[model samples]
Target: MTQEKLFASFLLDQTQGVEIALRAEQVTEATHIQGGIQKLPGSVDFLEGVMHLRDDVIPVINLKKRLGFTPDSYTQEAKVAVVSHFNTRYGLLFEDIKEVFRVKPEKILPINPALRTDDQAISALIKVEPGKRAVELLDLDHLFAGSNIDYTNEEPPHESTAKQRTYSRYVVFSSGGQEYGVSVEIAREITFCREINEIFRTGIVAGAIELRGRTIPIIDTQALFTNSETTELITDEHSRILILSAKNCSVGMIVDHIKEITTVADDSILPFPYSDNDNVKGMLSRLDGENTILLDVHNLLCNHVEAIKSMANIGNHKEQEHEDSDTGAHTVTHHLITENCYLIFSIGKNFAIEIKDVNEIIENDHVMRVPGASGCSTEVINLRGEVVPIINLRNFYQFDTKKKSETNKLIICSAHGQTVALEVDKIVTIYKQEQFYATPSLGNQLRSKKDTLDRLIEFLNDQEINEHVLVLNIHSLIRNHLQLETTSRQAADLHADQHADDTITEQAKG
Candidate 1:
């Protein structure tokens, strides 16, 4: 006789009737509450007290608290589900448990993007009945893997399962007649469009959605590809919104429609051709003769992240202006010093740079290759009848070379009469002298000589911004580039000298 596959799910009264399901085999036992539940000390609030079950003590988790719900008193109908994963057994307290439902492996849907934010607690989704509510299939693997839980001693699931081939799941969707894919882990949930409140003066932010009391900015994926302000997406239709969590902010990407949810073997994914499209992380072919472009959600939200930050600064500046108007100005006894302004940009998610040693910004035109120059200074461009060498900062920063884009701007600057052009992805706002405050901690990092991250970071003041902007070592950067150029010239001279010596030795032998 063949065994049957089943999924046990429960209802959470606190979460507006949202149902969470777990694999039936993973659930060891389920018991009704009989006595008082003990409280735990020095633990997270969601950790319900240890209770005796089956002659052994097991910690109970308050499902409401774990899922960000209001605390509720335990009812007589409440039951606890004992589940174990990675050798750690824990009990999950539920409002009520439904009868076990028989489901096949293919019937379960990969978690919808609408419910996913930053974690993969809910692994799958299933429709109980047509046009009825959907139940979320919970993955204890991710539930315990979060910061709230502690299971440090247990070995990772991959360590023991290494012999078995693993495939990464990807959520495939369509955009502008092209297929796109995002890793199932990072791709949160798929949601329908809601009332989108248009934000004025913010770039790339198509609108904002008030979801579950949190305001998430929406970026029209079609607008991103077309580079046009007019996103013809009808807000009222059955528009699908792919919610992505990156940089600790929830961003909703508006796609045409979700095509399907499937898994692709890791080895089968092919590298994307080199292009200026950083948004396209990679590509893979589907069995149906179609290529799915893997989208980088982080890159798509990069500009919006910075823009949102700058918007906060603008808000602070306005507030400061209003406050100053309300109160009369007074002369200060201490002389206020103005700091040098800096232009900010980022290389990746974490690395950022501020340039004070720049002259003028211009569009990147045809760059001529300098054969004998160093790797970092191999390209030169003609600007106003003068040939200027281009500095590829990625080379010095050890970042992969990104393809050039139309939006990429070159910052021209000179030190000691030597000029160079730096290519940066996006140009952040200019920080005035009084906008930011510098800490000697930056100087300490450089003086210590132990850490590679030596860039100075200045925290913005009330009249400036909310976050810290990294102040780059422009002087050091230019100096290093010049040093590399000099070293390359010296190496060329040495090679020429060795060649001459070899020729003379050959002539004498002849």
Candidate 2:
């Protein structure tokens, strides 16, 4: 007997409705259409603009229009269903999303070849019991056949190129009754205002909050601009934290609430007449007759270095306590000044590598495919004058192969004087003042003997939560996993020279 399969049902139109169902496994999530949509030039007719979904910018397609039906007016119940096809995610705009239901094999009926048309989107139909309406199963592979919609390569306009002006999106919020805007590139995420642990109550530093595994200092924007002292922190339903990244560190700023994510033209911004504050970059005049103060995020974060350092100290202290309790091991306290830095990135999951092991980080561009090099690396890129091998981390880790997008990054790392590039999904962030711990017994047994993951590191995510990230042992990875020699001629000569120097110093002391 065949097992039943689940399907997510939706309506194309409410009045003259056409019910459709997509396989539940393909649908990632259904979310409200927020921040509206930004139309793209030279795009297909049915390709509705793009919308920001958490960390990704997805292209929304009007399902009604794509199916030769007029799109209905968007109402409060309208939603964008995020679906995955070929490991690439896209947003399907629908009038309304119905419930997910199961269809038994007996009720599933395939469409006849004689009745199918050239543009047949319905592969099968589910006959409901009694008098319920039949649901048409959607064939996503056929619907998006030969479609070439790329939304990830849009780049921001450069300041020097005045003729090629493009629209830049900004996340706008209110602070101290005045609205301010920050570029979407720097704005990490918007989260609810959590209770802050007051480590430093001076100036605009309201306190600190544990986000993921790291402690981030919360800056009171009202106090910063007003030149006033820190007041009693208050919270309400509308309060939010606008997490901003600068200098490879994240800091949360308290805002009244997130108003909207909108795009502003490059020429639309006017220089601020007042020069009292360097943080205020420009002014954006909106249609509602209000001027939004565009802020320089880098300057704002750089000004609060002291507060940021204090938050890092708090994180280290808490991490030490956690480690001691878990392993019953009392480790020596390490100061923040001497702490090591790491580059955090994601392949399928989060992983960390020491920053010192990295030579540089570059974009995954112009990679040439090589034949018969499929074991560890199958692609190489010309970095400077050297032909550097590109290791697909997903393939090496045995993760599902995903379609590479423009946002993918390449990390140039070296071990034993041999350099290679690691292809990753995206660079998450650079973490400082972090500690490394030994991998647990269970992890050691599960991992391969030649695997690179021998240690664990912890970091905080955007949602103020902490998780363990596996640290890559680059030396072992090169020697054991890649079967490369542990030492180059130059490295061996340097090691011998160091030993000779030590012996001569010992002879002099004797």
Candidate 1 RMSD to the real structure? 26.8
What's the TM-score of every candidate structure?
0.34, 0.38
TM-score of 1: 0.34
lDDT, candidate 1, equals 0.62
The digit string of per-residue lDDT tens for model 1 on 1-510 reads 344456666766735777788886687655555355667688887787776542356778887777776655567667787787766667788876554455556566796667785666777787655367678878887788754554233344576565565677666667888988887667555666666755322346675665544456677777776776576765434357877767565677777755554545667778866778788767886545678888787776676565443322221222222223556764322111112434556554223333334445566778788875666678889987888888776665556778888656677776655677877765554444444444345443234321323444564533565566555555665565565566778898999999999999999999
For candidate 2, the clash count comes to 6
Predicted candidate 2 versus true structure: per-residue lDDT over 55-154, tens digit per residue? 4688988787788785435665567878888767788887765555566787888998679766677888888543668888889888888888758554
**Which consecutive 10 residues in model 2 have the weakest lDDT in total?**
314-323
